[model samples]
Target: MRRVVFLVQPQVYLLDLAGPAEVFHTARDFGLPYELSYVADEPEIITAELLPVRCATTWPALGANDIIIVPGKQCATLEDVNPSERALSMLRAHHRQGGMVVSVCAATEALGRAGLLDGRRCATHHQLQDELAARYPAAEVVRDVLYTVDGNLATSAGIASGIDLTLHLIATWHGPTTAGRIARALVVYARRNGSDEQVSALLRHRSHLSDLVHRLQDVIDERYTEPLRLAELSRKFGCSERTITRRFRDATGLTPLRYQQALRLERAEHLIASGTTVEAAARAVGFSDSRTLRALRAAGRTAAAVAS
Candidate 1:
């Protein structure tokens, strides 16, 4: 069985680590042959969000694993958990021998600190974007997307984006049919393309902007599955149609309809990955009909397969 060794550290966010653990372990839930284990610099009890989790091996004691996953923590201080020279050297040695390293959220900082990100494009928690940029000038800090995969190195933005990254990894390794099954078991959107930005106007439209825009985004996100219209949405917000349209577009970079289309496509991708029929996914995302959805789905499938 292939082994994925999760390198846990103090202050590791439980979700960032656990999400992939569950995804990889439950591959049996979809009939894959792989195993996941937790390791660290020492056999330590780790805490995240004040929760406790245990590790079984120290980093140096770890053997050749198929993959190593490093997750993020809440610590804003880089100096605290940045990889030590020893850890950095070990990671470089593993990658030099063709091992895969997966870093989620701010854990990419450790990779950057090790000089592994110097010429690569990577993502992290949006809050730490500037710090990563200043710290690793040779690293191409990709601020736009949810995740990035350059060669054997894969990185993702904070929290939930990690799930998307893992799903993408599974999709790449096990084929879309298997990946969709795992995603369905997880009750998550199956596949947010690595190219998808974590802070797209659509995502930010729902949360990261001014209070009013944020509220509007919340409504759109919740009701995106239902039929939505500019006039109705404008009236609900107590604003004119034009004002709502302008503001929505400004906040999310896509008009309300286009934004909904993107959301539906995102959701459709999830459904399709979960083994749903393309027609069903299209209707679920509120497509006017199935033809366009099929066409779009075909185009996307072609693109992803080619990318792989």
Candidate 2:
């Protein structure tokens, strides 16, 4: 099993620790081979939110595929927070051994101090970006992005962005479909790859507050590859076909059938880009023939060309 170890520190941000932890935990629940653990220099650490958290004092043995995450903490400035040399050494040793090391928000300061950020591109919370850059001259501090991954070392902008970063990692390890399922379980949009234009079609058109439409979306997202009937959905949801169509359009600016087609088209594009043949991609995404997939691809290209 792949172990995910969170290196807990004093004044750790609660959300920074919980968000990614929940993503891994949820992924584990979905039968992924993941084990979550927490370690710290002491048995108890007081969080930034004034809550006491208990963790293991002894570090666990980690393999190359394992991960160690340093969650962001609360500090006035980089100088105000001093990490133990043992902790820094551990961070350096783990990365040197080819294990993955991650930092969230101000925790990038810890990675920076450990020399892991030297000549590496990293990201931190927006408020600490300037200070992180000034303190670590060798590190390239990326701005306006949720996270950055340089080799085995990764850094995120903390808080909710931590979730995005973790989801990205999950997608890398598993696939986009598994990550999308986990995101749906968390009631969040599927991982946004640090760009509005790159949001996954699995999560697009999900900003509305309509529970009915959202449920319809969940159904479509799960069964887009199958032949779904709006009348069946209307019967299942106890709504008229007209109501389902109107509400879906009102919430997402697309009918249910169109939304499902969008999912199929996006997935087909990914498969094709990954070297799958057009006919195979069409069959995989549930198209009856290559002609329909070709038509959709042509229309998509036309739309993009027009938009440009």
Candidate 3:
């Protein structure tokens, strides 16, 4: 079992702790062995929202595969946040032992205090990016990213982004399919990547509340690499093809086929970035040939340029 321990601090941001925790907790429902626990210097602390939270006073024995997450707290400045010396030492020792250390939002200040951010790429809340960089000059503070993972250290921009970061970690350990399922369970429209500064194609144009379109998007998300027919989808969803098509377009501003292609294209770009050949990436995403992929890529670039 992989133990995920949350290092809860005083004045903790509830969402920063709860969001990632829920992702791990939800993954257990899918047969992933994630053991959740919380630890803090005191047995009880109050949250930033003025809510009481109880936790274990003692830290658990962790192995290389274990994970420790430091949830962010409310503080006027990075210097105003003070973690116990023992906690800072524990953070350092955990990293030295090859265990993963994660920070959400301003809690990255704690990791920086522990000297873990030195010479590593890290991210924190946009408001603290400058302060983090100034304080930890040796660390490469990445801006405009949801999160950054360098070796065993992972830091997120905080708040809801913590959920995105945890989902990404789940995807890394398990697989994209498993992560996708969890996202669907959470009703998250899409899993944004660490590199995305804006909404992803999978997330864009998904603001409408049509249940049928949402369900159709979920199916396409899972089967984007396979041959999917609108007729088959219509029969499965008990709707006519024309109705499905019109509703999908009305809800997402794109036809179902276009939505599937967008997913395929997004994944193909990632594969190509990782050194896959154009033809191989196209084939991997269910394109009949590289020519279609190339044309789509060119069109996307032109559209982006026009938008800019």
Per-residue lDDT tens digits of candidate 3, residues 174-215? 756678778768888766889875544656756788888878
Q: Which ten residues in a row have the lowest lDDT in candidate 1?
A: 199-208
Q: Give lDDT: candidate 3, residue 200.
A: 49
Candidate 1 residues 142-234, lDDT tens each?
996889888778899978888888877886676544565576567663356777533222333443355666667667666777888888888
Local accuracy by lDDT, each model: 0.74, 0.88, 0.90
Count residue pairs with overlapping backbones in model 3.
Answer: 0
Candidate 1, residue 243: how far the Cα is off, in Å = 42
Per-model C-alpha RMSD: 11.0, 3.6, 2.7
Candidate 2: list runs displaced more than 4 Å.
189-191, 196-199, 209-212, 225-244, 265-308
Off by over 4 Å in 3: 174-181, 187-197, 200-202, 273-280
Model 1 error, position 160 (Å)? 1.3
At residue 169, candidate 2 shows an lDDT of 85
Ranking by TM-score: 3, 2, 1
Q: Report the C-alpha displacement of residue 106, candidate 1, in angstroms.
A: 0.8
- After superposing all C-alphas onto the true structure, candidate 1 shows an RMSD in angstroms of 11.0
Top candidate on TM-score is 3
How well is each residue in 105-222 modelled by candidate 2, as lDDT tens digits? 8899999889898899999988999999999988999987989888899999878888988987886677667788898889987468753336777777877899999889888877
Against the hidden true structure, what lDDT does model 2 obtain?
A: 0.88
